[model samples]
Structure formats: C-alpha cells, structure tokens
Target: MEHTGVVHKIIVAGIGPGNPDYLVPAACKAIAGAKALVGGRRALAQYAASDGAGQHIMAVTRDIEAVMAFIQEELHERDVVVMVSGDPGYYSLLDAIKRKFPSECIRVIPGISAMQLAFARMNLPWHDARLVSFHGRQPERSALLYQKGAVMGMLTDAKFTSRTIPLILMECGWPGEAKLHICTRLSYDDEKVVTIRLREAENYPEAKNGILLVEG
Candidate 1:
C-alpha cells in the first residue's frame, strides 16, 4: 500500500526498555517536539511527566489496524510520533506500519532493546547470540535454536518464565546441562537476573516480561 498523501509524518521511535536514561537524546527530542504521540501503555508511562503537548494512544495488543488508522488521522494535520518498546526493529510494530506507509514519509529512531540490557547485565558477549521472542506465540520453536555452545537470547511471556523455558528445552533434548540467565523486568526498578542450570530453572516461579540467555 502506497501512502502518498501527507498525513503527519510518522516518527517511529524506540524508548528503550523502561529507563529514561536509556532513551536516546534524539528520540527524546523527537517525542518531546512532536505534536502527538502514540504507543502502548508501557511506552506512554515512560513519558507520563513530559511537558510536551501530544495526544497519546495506548493499544491493548498489536492492533496494527487501529494504530495505522490513528497514524493516518494524525498525519493529516500534525507532526506525529509513535513510541515502541525496545528497538522498533526487534519484533516490533514497525514492519507492519512501514508496509502500509511509504518509506520516504516514515522515519525510525532506534533504542536499546531488552536483549542488549540483559546481555549487558550478564556481562556476556552477544556477538554470537541468537535472539528470539515468545511473547505472542509458543516458545517451542525458539527452544530448538538453543544448541550446545551457542548463546540464545529470548523474549518471554508471563506464562513462560525463567523456569518454563528449561522444561521446553528438556523436551527438545537440550542436554539438561547449560547455563541459564533469566533477566526479568529489564531496565525497570524491580528488575532481577537469576542464574541457574537448565534443569534447576524448572522450579522457579513465573515473572513478567523476561529475556532468557542460555549457553553451554
């Protein structure tokens, strides 16, 4: 779909995980200067105290249609900014939006993703790490990517916590012998990182948003 008409320009910016410091200056300026802002609840919360004047739209899920419709409306008469969690390119809503809008009219501002923060906290070199997300689907496929001596970065859901992932790995024949680093609520005040053996993780409780790093 070719979006030709000048609605407002859509500035898709990433607001980091949940920390303001991680928010890049350019992204902060874009958001603060925009006439309108749109994103999920978590994204909106990060800018709750901003003095900038902009309308906020918090979608429940990946309601691309609704978000696009809102974007179209904003483009008609104002400079619009959309906030996405982590980097917009990392399994985010950017691709869908870009599919509908022309590239010339859309600008993307990248931010620090949870995977980066997770690896940073663990002091692990992620150059060879494989990243995956189980946020809206089953993590079985993701588990298969975890091979011996390979580093795996995973985005997990509430139901699939630090512990649940090990169960999946065990079922997939992942040698019950790997180091597991589970980062939950990354970049947030209550953030916690737990390390355990793949077999021991099964006994842990569930967490909110999680990033699992498995290596052998």
Candidate 2:
C-alpha cells in the first residue's frame, strides 16, 4: 500500500469546571480516542488521573509559540485533543486554537462553564448578564458595566481574587452597600457560595477559584 500522511484532526474540548462529574460524555469519548492531549497543568492533572492514560499529554508552555509548535508537529501523525478548563469558547483556548488551525480542521466540544454553574446556584437568569474575564488582566471595564446597571458575571483568577474584586469596584466608585454573589472553589469538596455586601468582601479569607455575580 502506498503511504499517504494521516489527515490530522484536533478536538478543542472543554472539560468543565474542575469536576469529573461535570465532564460531558462526548468530551470523554473524544479524549479517550485522542493520541495527544494539550492544556494547562492543573486541567491536565485532573484528566490524566482519570481519562488520560496511554495518551501523550503536553502542558501549555508559557511561550504560546512553543505550545502551538508542539501541536502543529504532533498533528502531522494523529489527532490531538486540547483540553480547556471551562467552555472552550469563553475566555479560553478557542482563540489560539482557531488562529493556528483552520476552522475546518477543528471540532469543538462544549462543556459546562463555571459561570453557568454559579448562576444556577444563585437561581438567577444570566441571559441579560454582562460577562467578563479578569483571568490575567484587571477589571478596568467593570466600572462601565456597573454604571450601566448591567448584571455581571465574571471569571476571576489569583490576580483578581474574590477579595480583590470588591476593592477594584470600590476604587471604581461602586457603592459598597451593593450585594455581591460569590462562588469559590465551585464543584470541589470545599465549594462555597455566599451573597454579601461589597464592603464585607474586603475581609473575606478564601479568595481563590472565585466566580463573581455582581448586580450593577
């Protein structure tokens, strides 16, 4: 048989908000079939222990160019699964993947986002919410969202922890009396969700893995 190169494929999979139960069946199936997997170290840790044995897994390098290069090289032989922490489309790896690979060569499998879960916990509708990401950046536009009276949903990281959000809003002249709905370490054993005044948030102890629901 004359040898022709394999038609490499990539599945941009969202594994959900740090819980195995939240992982969709389709994503599980795609991951099981992948020859190579790529994502953040934490996300890979969760998947590697459960569904990633026998697959070549790679962590996203600090230099995005390196990560992209690895994927490009691997895709020449087999399919690669890029695991994103939440919904891949929301403030996630989707943009980078799309830029490197053509849309026709990639398939996206959606997962439950932390924002969706946080809203569900509050029993509030998010259709009208203004979504923002303070993952690695400051919440500069958050003030505008507050001024417009937009119900806001935000994804936060170590830099913009739960405690810091209130401080930023306070600096932005947001009223300290307004209520903040915060969900921290969601879907984990230590998950906590509470609605408290903006002023109270300044003293909160646990500030990691936080999602914020701020009423504008």
Candidate 3:
C-alpha cells in the first residue's frame, strides 16, 4: 500500500467499557494522536471533544466494507485508529481489521473488557468461568456450554438479556435455582449490579451493555 511518503499505520485500540475512567493510558495515548477514528457510535461520542478533535470520525456499523474504505483513505495520508469495545483480542473487530490491513502496519493496545468489569464489580475471579457472547448469535449454537453446574460469564445484547438468556440456559440444562449476577452498564455512573435466581430474571429488562454471570 502506498502512503504519503510514510509507512501506513493502523492502531487497533481497545476503548474499554463505556466510561472514560476505564480507558487505559496506552489506548488513550494512541487516540490522542489519531488522524481518523473508527469505532462504534458510543465510543466516538465519549472522546469526540478530547482525543477525537479534528479527527475524521466514522461509526462502525453493519457495513464492514465502508469502514475498511474509510480507514484506507485515511491511511494514505496519516495514521488511523480503529477502536473496539472491550479487549481487541476478544470477540471484536480485531480479526476483521487484521484481514483488511497488513499485520506489520497495525498495532494493538488492549483495554479492560466489560466481562472483566463485570467480574470485578461482583468481586468474582473469572478465569474459571465459561465465557460466551450472544451478541449476534443463537444460544442453541453453544448448547454444550450450559452445563448443569458451572460458572459462566455471558456477554449479552439487546436480543439476549436476563429476560431471555436465563430461560434459554435453563432449557439447555442449567438449573433454575442457579444464581444470576446481572451486571449492566459497567464502568458508567449508571452502572447496576444485581443478583437473582435464574428463574427470577424475567423481571429484569434488556441491556445494551451487560454481562450475566451464571454461577452454580
């Protein structure tokens, strides 16, 4: 790829949970000097005035092609920063970005994931938990993960929530008596953490950013 007499650069930065407080110094430093910012709408809004000032802002949507085009255009002139929610290594845009740009030209700065925040808020060690994401997937696909008794961390979405997920797990063999730790809007001022049995989760509403802990 030809650049403006400069090596093409792309920084895949993990912006952490929604709150600015959770953003790590390394990621913050990279964003400070970014020429173009590509991330979800919420992330751009969070840093728009500070790190995103005078930078080309592009919201990543279902259109992956458009995002790649925008990044490429920016790369020809200057470095571009592609931000992802949570740790870039997790179920994020890191893999897609890697395929679009050369590995040598890309640098990744990891940040705290919502799941990590969820575990932290609940004061539970997470290494033993079976983690899953139902962001754009079906629970039935990961049927084997719903063991009768096990520690599980699930990253939920609008379609999948405490209202729906707990019942789905129960149908997949999880016991109704199992505890559900519903951690929502982590790292933000409005963050909420609640505990209830899996059977009683129907009363809770959906959360755009939430993690559900299914503890045995």
TM-score: model 1 vs. ground truth: 0.88
lDDT of each: 0.78, 0.80, 0.82
lDDT of 1 by residue, 61-118 (tens): 6576887887777777886788888899998888888888887788899999999999
Candidate 3: minimum summed lDDT over ten consecutive residues — where?
139-148
TM-score of each: 0.88, 0.87, 0.88
For model 1, what is the error of residue 163's alpha carbon versus the real structure, in angstroms, after optimal superposition?
Answer: 2.3
Identify the superior model by lDDT, candidate 2 or candidate 3. Answer: 3
Candidate 2: worst-modelled 10 consecutive residues by lDDT: 139-148
* Residue 119 CA displacement from its true place in model 2, Å: 0.7
State which candidate, 1 or 3, has the greater lDDT.
Answer: 3
